[model samples]
Target: MPWGEIKDTAAERRMFQRRTLVMLGVAVLLLGVLIGRMYQLQVTEHDTYRTLSDKNRVQVQSVPPTRGLIYDRNGVLLAENRPVFSVTLVPERVAGMDATLEKLQQLLSISEEDLDRFRRRLREPRRPYQELPLRYDLTEGEIARLAVHRHELPGVEVAAELVRYYPHGELTAHALGYVGRINRQELQRIDPVNYAGSNYIGKTGIEAFYEEVLHGKVGYQHVETNARGRTLRVLERQNPVPGEDLQLHLDIRLQQLAHELLDGRRGAIVAIDPNTGGLLALASVPGFDANLFVTGIGVQAYRELRDSHDKPLFNRALGGQYPPASTVKPMMAIAALDSGVIGRHETIWDPGYFQLTKGGHRYRDWKRGGHGWVDLIKAVAESCDTYFYDVAVRMGVDVIHEYLDQFGFGRNDALDVRGARSGLLPSPDWKRGAHSQPWYPGDTVNMGIGQGFMLATPLQLATATAVIANDGVWRQPRLLKDVVGDTPLDEVLPKATRDNVILKNPDDWNFVTKSMIEVMHGRRGSARRASVGASYTMAGKSGTAQVFSLGQDEEYNAEEIEERLRDHALFVGFAPVVDPQIVVSVIIENGGGGSSAAAPVVRALFDAWLEGFADEETGAELAAAGSAGESSG
Candidate 1:
């Protein structure tokens, strides 16, 4: 007062001092807390914070391995990989998926299919931050457009990848198969870690069968990325291992020749190396382009293929089932001889037909006037149905089933042949099971000629013929020849399923083989005309399988029947009788006669293989073998 006159000086001084001290103490405490917090963040939690920071700037990305190249035995490339650019997006990185996809569509002109496929993939479970493809095979214009808009669109990327290519296109379609986009089903089956970045998977044929060997190991890389998720640089990389290259036993030249031989017809041709059981050529006419399937085939293109009457998508070589017809006669003869039902020299009198009783229903022979008194060799050469019918009734169905089963009928158990159908071999048990009917004597007669309930795939026919060529040594038919790397084929692939067809008399093989040769060289041989002027010896059997049974008094006239209802002409043979090199099976659908339509085609194959493709020494050696075999016989 008066300024301090009326004030209590001591008390005011003490309170002032206390307040200052209290304020100072509080300040010191706050500062200490700040310092402690700073130390905790910058020292104790340093590693954790630093790791979190680095995660925002860096990423570990999967690198897909290059798919293996598939080549023919002659080093002709069948399947390869070509580089392509595609558009992709990572869902987690996008702010608004619907808006981003809309903007992408506007910028890239994306189709409804692409949108649908993208949405479908979005619904599937995937690794966090993994990029999903929206469009494939982007053009330069589209890439440029996307690049200009990339900054505005988060998670969008233009990635370059390798897609599968088939050089031969439609020619090797069924044989080599094709790769396709990994669908939902495939995604479930595939190893997620191994196929993290893979988009394509084998869909069929060799591609499907060897998918594991063809799809190599996955690799990873540490990548530095900008805020917009654009990869600035690769920080560290672990290169992926490429898949094992495959060298198949398929010969492109032989394959092309077979295609040419079966041109303009619905048929299949199967050629095998008798010595190795390797498939040289497997041709199914009217094949489609395999390349279309590599990058997700269009709806229209796939529908066309799926609906076509020609069945271009079908693998006729491995799947087409037809009666082996007289082509099975040689095997039947072996069966008869081994079972002691008939001798090599046993004769049966044919009066144009066979009868179970003296006045029973007649099973007419193809030849109107009968082959007269015919032995086993004559019966096989002339294709005398009556002889086989007589023996079939005598031997019964049980014996026939047992013998044919030994020859690989009623089963498609080859190690490398995928999706091959087992043809039916009828027996008492089978007839009872399948049709609820007992096996009849007439059924046995029909089985004798490879008819009635008997059905055989072209592959089985070729394999059986190959077994015959190998002198009853059964080696499983295979397409894989070698793995083009340090690994041996045996280590990489499953061992071939094999067995020997034991015969009572081993010489019986020689007898059947010799008789088959006569069918090509004899005076009255059914297929003799097909062998005119041949330098090499070819043992063959021709057969005609009826599409529909004829009336007892009616003869088969091709002009009267519909084209599709005509007989299926068939022929099976091996060249160089003494040392068989190739065994061929041909089936011409709806062809009138086997001798005329199918046998000539087989002869042409023989000429192309033995003369056109064979070396001079090979021809000479085969010629000498033929001469020696003829003279001895």
Candidate 2:
């Protein structure tokens, strides 16, 4: 090797060594960058990636709380929770919803309606993995079939849920109401935070009125889940508070008794504890089964209920508005005495018809043959339309309207129950305001006998009867006694006015009560047939409100008219007149002659109540006069 060759070789070797060192450095730098990036992803965002992975494996779901129970005053269950197995679906978990549903239908009989509802629920904006109810109250056979094919279905699930049950069925349906599955309408209205895990909501009646107390507060669980959204473990849980129980004022025994008395009739019966204003029995005949509404009533069942001629869904006790008929006579008599329009003993001659001097309209009495000369007491006892016509002419509509309004007649009772209709109390002003019509003299005469534009609900009539029983003390009628596990009801119902009746003479109350007594015990009492063999004295007035007007020459022969076209029978009374404890109001639709139909029903109710009282009192006489005066004539 020459010296130049040695120098060039040395330079080449140095350059090769430098290039090797530079390559080694570049490789080390690339390796360090790769290691740093891997560590950053694995350690810094571990939780975010882990959650995503766990979601694909585990499924977590919300468990709705059980609804509260409802009981009658006697501890009989009205509304309760029953365990129900239901098929549910999670649309997000389903690969092909239509195909899955088709398979589901093949496994279990699924109607078009069920499929339609399921599809609708799927379309609604909801959180992923949230179960949508597909079918409720699945039979054991259906459950078994679904379980056998459980592996074929991924998104479908069967779960036990607490569904509302009404054991009494139709008997207590209107009062207890029912609960139904939560819907979009309810979702928007409900507090999402509170109802985060809730399934059902109160639809109507007492259930709806006290929903807050009945629906328990929602709870939360912090759960660990897998990539499939399956739950790994519950890290923390806050136990849910169960709903408080409800004890209503309704008496099941009396309620059943009243229901029996109505017996296939379309009407209403309301019985109240005169002393406490607690509703004993508020029964509307032709009631529906509340249980049908719980899990979701079928379209056919719902349509039948809605379209039925009997109107089984109608709540007549609280909602039916009808002319009070001659049941208003006792109140009118009291009003007349209080207004100083007629003396208690003042006699009004009845020629079977009343004619206003100015108005040529002849207001005919119920009796074609004259009731003849009758006083206020006799008029009320015999329910003489002519006599009341005379008193009404003297008292005028203003005086009657003012006095009746005070007694809750033609007024809303503002009952705790939802959908209570305030019946029309048509005065000259009310008529003018509502119908844009002037008051007529004939209207006053019609009102005198509980006819014309005068209307009242069974509840209002019962409440008014209670006030009359208490000597004008108008206690506010109440349905709910108290809510369990809560502060006592804060509302102090208004006291019955001590001086409700403006009658200066205290004897006036005595006189009217005496007249009512005669109506039951008197021989000529219109309700005489119903009051046969009465052990206790009852004060009542029978009323017959014409469904359609008959011409002056036309006689009201009930048999001649169609059954639906007949008059409405009304009866209002309080038992054991001396120390009245129960007040009853009954109305029978197109039942003809309050004395014949309505009064007999009331008499039966009184008999049942008085019989119970007699048993408790060891055969003590509830009323001093077993038989007072019988004067229907």
Candidate 3:
């Protein structure tokens, strides 16, 4: 028993000793490995670990600044920013995206379009932890619903953002333009560095023209984050500088008045202050709501606007190209008088129609019975087509082209607002370049009476009328009056003066101006019907542009024509003849006669504008008379 027990005890002791050694060796090896790893991380790879740790704890995010406001001359707000609520999501923090979306759909009513947009945004290669916009312009009900069940929705949050808004709605849509969400096309055009925080950009008009001024400088903030990459606190922030406010040259009162006068008609009216390049009113009828474009117009609404028959999206004032018609008469008369093609008192026999000797094409007058023998002054006053036809042929196409071009015709005016179309001032070179054709005298005769290849934008016609009103001192038409803020008015470069045809004889200008006055004030004037009881005299010309070509012997029967096929009506005029304050150009689509359709609109505009001054003068006169009577008593 003693010998066996001794052997078992020795074996047991030996086994215990081996087990203890193995356990100690394993512990030592683990300690060595852990120490080596600690050295590698703390010393050798210090920068890498530090950066990773910093990334987890601190984040630098962009903060967008408030866009500046746009106002009319009278301090009426045109374009502004309003607070909007949106639903945002961080993709990295969202677990099981499809499940979350399904849950959200149950909790809140989500549209297919909204889901599509959300999925599209998630697919973008943005920072995983950065918040991305999911749904914008959320209703109060949606916001309230989300708030009540916010704890159930991880990675989803409601955020307040400043959104662009147009207060005047459709009235100033084209002129003021509107801001829209940044798209791929816009991103490519914008400066990547500066636009890092910007989500909206100006798409057209003054907004596009002054993007740099309207869009403020971007800012940054240092933020703290939690383990889930959600923002904990904003550690540091640099306040953003707001964009410079713009005061436009447009008068809201006049603009509203002009827009009201246009009513439901599809047309354009542009009025300019003759002294300053300031545009008083720019009215394009059937305008769409600019607010629709601010966020993103739905496909249905956008398609409707794009396909509408009246073309609400179209900017008729600046972009619609139409034949100047007889509105070009005043300008042509100026050209004729200045070129010595016709004397003011010289008479041309109009036998109902003008026959081109070479082509034998008889261009008829508005008056079928003919204006008979008409002098230069009388021709302009009556808008005698045969007389202008005779003068145009005598003056030649080259002279007409050169003179009209000088008056901002056939070329862009470089207006403050963007998208100005250069009207066609056809010439020999233009015909050759544009249509690869030779110039003909028949073409000259047609162009002479604002027909043929002659086309003009409402803006061009308005600006030309302004030049005549200013007696040939052409100022570049401007929409911006001043940039308010620390930026001085001098900071904006003064618009360069453009001189076209300078009147060699001042008497020629006076003669043409006087004749235009007679057009509204004369006994037999075409626009005489509208001139009835006008407080101030208006100098204007009426034009009827044919929608379809007539045969040599065919008469223009506006009554028999369909409304769409009727003649386009046009009128251009300046008020108070001697001291011209406002110059206007009006065009009525498919409206039979300029006197009947277009001139009346201008008369209303003139009445509206003059009525303000008349009111002020009347008030002053009554006050003065009361004081005088009191003193006399």
Cα deviation at 186, candidate 3, in Å, is 1.4
lDDT score at residue 542, model 2, on the 0-100 scale: 80
2 or 3, which is superior by lDDT?
A: 3
Summarize candidate 2's per-residue lDDT along 249-296 as a digit string, tens digits: 888777877777777889999999888788888899999988888767
Candidate 1 displacement at residue 341 in angstroms: 0.4
Question: Candidates' lDDT values, in order?
Answer: 0.85, 0.79, 0.81
lDDT of model 1, residue 281 = 90
lDDT of 1 by residue, 480-592 (tens): 99999766788877786657898878999989988899889998788887787889999999888888998889988788888999988888999989898889998888966
lDDT of 1: 0.85
Quote the lDDT for 31 in model 1: 100
Top lDDT model: 1
Query: What lDDT score goes with residue 469 in model 2?
Result: 90
Off by over 4 Å in 3: 1-48, 120-131, 489-497, 613-633
Pairs that collide in candidate 3 are none
Per-model TM values vs. the true structure? 0.94, 0.90, 0.89
TM-score of 3: 0.89
